[model samples]
Target: MGEPVRSLPHLVGRRLSRVVVLIAVILSGLLLGAGIEAQEADNSTANLPTDAESAVAARVQERLGTAEFTPAIVVFDRGGDALTDEDRDVVQRKLSELQELAAPGQQVFPVLAEDGQAAFVGVPISAETPEEELAEPVAALRDAAAEGLPEGLRAQVTGGPAFIVDLSQVFDGADVRLLAVTASVVALLLLLTYRSPWLWLVPLSVVGVADQVAVQVVAAATQVFGFSTDGASVGITSVLVFGAGTNYALLLIARYREELRLVEDRYDAMRRAVDRAAPAILASSGTVVLALLCLGLADNPTSRNIGFGGALGIATAVGYALLVLPAAMTCFGRGLFWPFVPRVGDADPTRSGLWARVGHAVTARPVVVAVAGTLVILVCAGPALGVKVGLSETEQFRAEPEAVTGQLVLAEHFPAGSSQPTTVIVATEDRDRVESGVARVQGVQRVESAGEGEGSAVLSVVLDAEPASADAFAVIEEIRAVAAQQSPGALVGGPDAEALDASDAAARDQLLIIPLILVVVTLVLLVLLRSVVAAAILVLTVVATYGASLGASWVAFRTFFDFPALDLSVPLLGFLFLVALGVDYNIFLITRAKEEAEEHETKEAIATALAVTGGVITSAGVLLAAVFTVLGVLPLITLTQIGVIVGFGVLLDTLLVRSVLVPALVTLLGRRFWWPGRLSHDGRHDGRHDGRQGSPAGHVAD
Candidate 1:
């Protein structure tokens, strides 16, 4: 029989009152944290970070110290187009008006280019000005320019803030739709799984708190550290914070219910539940935070910012789960599972019937189950090898009217790669020679001669492809080689080439970090479960699922999105989510499986564990997927990619990893499902065996 609940005296509610007091202190601290940042208007957009903007800022700072510069509209007209004296006078007056309108960093420098075909206008973006504050100024300038434009002349505003604002308008509604669809699917799954109002209500309730806490923490961090958040990071953080936080909460709650059957007192049961699940929760959260932390390897500030924000979110989730959850459970007591099918003082049905039958069948034919499950995984995985990660910010605005108009305007007047590229700046002992040398780079399709200063000149070379493309990087290398041979002193720096270098380095970093995380996670599993083989198997499964998910994403995006493939970050992000969340599920299932097997046969244990935990995980996965799907509706390519990839991964984890792969693998392993552990033979009854028979070789719990 199972050991008495009190037999493991050390594991009981030791210092329960103190733990409760600690939770109270934490909740108070979190509340105090909330008040640290005064509530403001719902300027949610302003809270979003802009890594691209940060990249541009870094470049500008390098070029011209930390001094401010205003974004301006450059007007162009055909040469020799005679302007009436009145029109010329009007233009002159408007220029002065714009100059007078300038404020600190918000100044305008209006200039008509010497060719008369183009004019440059500069407007300073104030250091203190938030994004929303610039709209009126931008609109006023556009209206002023449009009103002053002579017939057949066109004016274009190309500046940092203007572009970001335009892009934001395009992506406005995208995230909402995706969020709605994802939430619906998750709620449906939850309803099916628990069929309990309390279960559904708990996740939804905790998700709100999680979302608020993450955003507030992120914003506060950025403010304190003087760091900036990009638009892409904001949406991705929201989904991750919500999905992962809710998943952790579910793990704790589900474990609590399971432990309920084995213990008499409600508080005592919760204490056991916390002790059993806390280590797994801590380990899983660590893996996720570590994966995100690894993103700091990228030189890209965007990825770094995401890593910071994401790490913060995961940390917050862990703290909240450990402290807040237990307190809430204690406060609610039995009512926590009330108005639902409470398992209070009752035997769980998982030990017998359908669960038992399936368990018995699996043990009887482990090879068949394992082989069939492998076949299914292989089928799903075959299409995944072609997965691609290509992202374009323009795609996020496809559903927006303003974005459509802006994109059309841009396409008509600009090359597809006009928005970005590697610019090779040539400076040499002899500037004339540098220009001539830069002109010879093979892949460079166009070169504009800039700054004919004494003994100095700059060459702006535009390549044939997007600057971030690998082909573009190759071109940069060739150009650098040519420059070295000819004008060796030239500094080649631009978004494209820099991004390529950063991307390559990040790729290598991910390779190193993936294995590191695996090892660490595996170690955690080994220590917690006391089974080396089980930990290895779980880790291997998670890694395989990641690869398969990536492959499938490549196919989906390539065929349907008509985009290139996936982003450079897909692999790392996929691994992070898959491994961390995958392990979370593993802990829930394997721990329960071990509990059952310790008192019964391996098959019976597997069956009972599946019945008890399978439905909850499936529901959690659905909810998590739904949360990610909301990102697909976001008007940004980055968010959409994250949503699709993470959503795909969660579904795969649920249906494949949890439902079939794990069960099949365990069955095949059989008696060795636990290699260095022995089954309990005592007739002492834990609630699991109250109404059920142990396997033939074992005595049932009394």
Candidate 2:
């Protein structure tokens, strides 16, 4: 008689109980460390500003008089032909009202600019100004501008601080909408896949717990480390944490159910499930974790933080999957696969009509199938060459009234490049000469000499394009070239040009990092699988999938959404995530295929692998896609980019790469795919029990 399924779980339970105690102890320490880190992280901001940012601030201080750029700007148009008596009166009153908004520690500067038609009253916010202090002052200023205005004139206000506050207030509602939609769709998909509410709870509950742990831990860590999130990146955190967590849970549960179907006693089923599934899940999670950690190599603070947070999430999911999942499965036992409980029978590969056809087609003309699949990938990759890279923050709220108003004001008064333009600072003993040199540079609309000292002079060079644009890079290089000839002694430094330069340099660095990380990661897989050829092909397939996904995202965003080219970092991130996590499905499917091949013939092997592993990978992919879709619904362009790119990327990985590409490629390659391994040369391996049983059955049994 077959070994009782209960026996598997009993074995697991005996071993796991001991490990659980040790885990509890380690978890306690991590929790305490996290608590301490949380406090430290919260205060971390105080310790930072040491490097380039601080240097930039010091340079700006010379001409700006220590009055840093107030993130708040004031706008009130004067009556026609400059301010009339009435306009003057209104402006004075508005200024008076704005004074009341100034908190004890805050500073607000009132200024005026008049064109032929009207005048705009403005304010520059200080660096350390608090939102609470700015809100009331800004609101009062707006009210004053609104009152006593000339008939044709109107008053409006906009600024980064205000935008953040506005987005924050509305984000709660947006998040609510996002969560409701995500939960509904996900629940529907799960129910459809499982056909049982009882089994569906496993993934839902697991993902929910994992989400809490990831978010809370990341929040607590950032707070302790003193990392503050940008408004857009803040929204992204939710989608990433939940989406990845759910993907992990679905894979684990699917494997558990599949194992339970074959092993009768519930306990043994869970143990076998853990043994069979955990390795692939862990492998996938490990690759992702390592890739994210690679983000630490970035010079940009934003990229660095994202990398840290992402790595943390991947790591947490790995831990939960290996430990908590086992514990929970042990508790549920046979009931875990309830409503469609396994009948202690082998899976029948030919049971599904769909599988029968796919199996026949795959083996019938493997070359034709492989060539056709390759053609599809090459065709989809065409748009990738047209991809561009840049971001417009205002695009986040293209439909919002405030964003529209803000854009109008900026276009009318400010330089088109005013949104964080690249400032080229040429410091020299001859300040006046350096300023003249900067002004002469092509594309430089204006140059302001800042600071007064014996050794230094800071010149702010405003370019004609947004700082993140390719044009801006050209402008910066022009300024540098001109300044080098004119001011041989000047030190050039500013946030605008420096940030762009750093980002470009970082992108180059990632190119090298990708291959290095890939080799290291693939090596790990190689050791685990003990097959060099399998490792090489797996990496190659994942790369193809990533490229296809990126190309598709470029078209979707650029053509459909009318977004600018994909984010510069998207390719790097896409490579890391798809390559790492994408390989998980490969490991799951291929390993199973190998086991089947050991016992059954090649045709039967491919059929059996798909029957057992396909459903689980598909479910996992959908869950991941649902979670990522939350990013698309957010009101920020950055998150939206991340959402669509990753969501589509995962889909491509599952539907195309995992489902067709890898399987077809493996079938075409056949035994050659596992070269140098003992299994490849010999027709036997101990892992396959089918051979001993004479291949009596070669199909999934429901």
TM-score of each: 0.76, 0.83
lDDT score, candidate 1: 0.60
Once fitted onto the true fold, the runs of candidate 1 whose alpha carbons sit more than 4 angstroms away are 1-137, 141-161, 167-193, 196-199, 219-228, 259-264, 333-345, 352-361, 392-422, 426-428, 443-449, 452-457, 463-471, 673-702
Give the per-residue lDDT digits (tens) of candidate 2, residues 1-702.
122122123324655644663574466456645643322121112112334442454456545453355435555553334546676566666765665554445555554543533344445555455554555655665666577666866776665555545555445566457656666666777788778767667566555555556665777767776554543444454555566666666766766666666767665666666666666666677777777777666555555566677777777766766667666656555655557765667564334746456655676777877787778777777788887765534444524645346545554655655433444444555667767877777777787754444445556666666544567667766766777677663444443455455556556646766886688678867876677888898888788877777788888887788886555555666676667767877877776676666556555666567666777777777777667766666666656776677778788777777777677777777767767665565454323543453221211110
Query: Best by TM-score, which number?
Result: 2
Which RMSD values do the candidates have, in order? 7.0, 5.4
CA lDDT, candidate 2, residue 71: 36
**Whole-model lDDT per candidate:** 0.60, 0.61
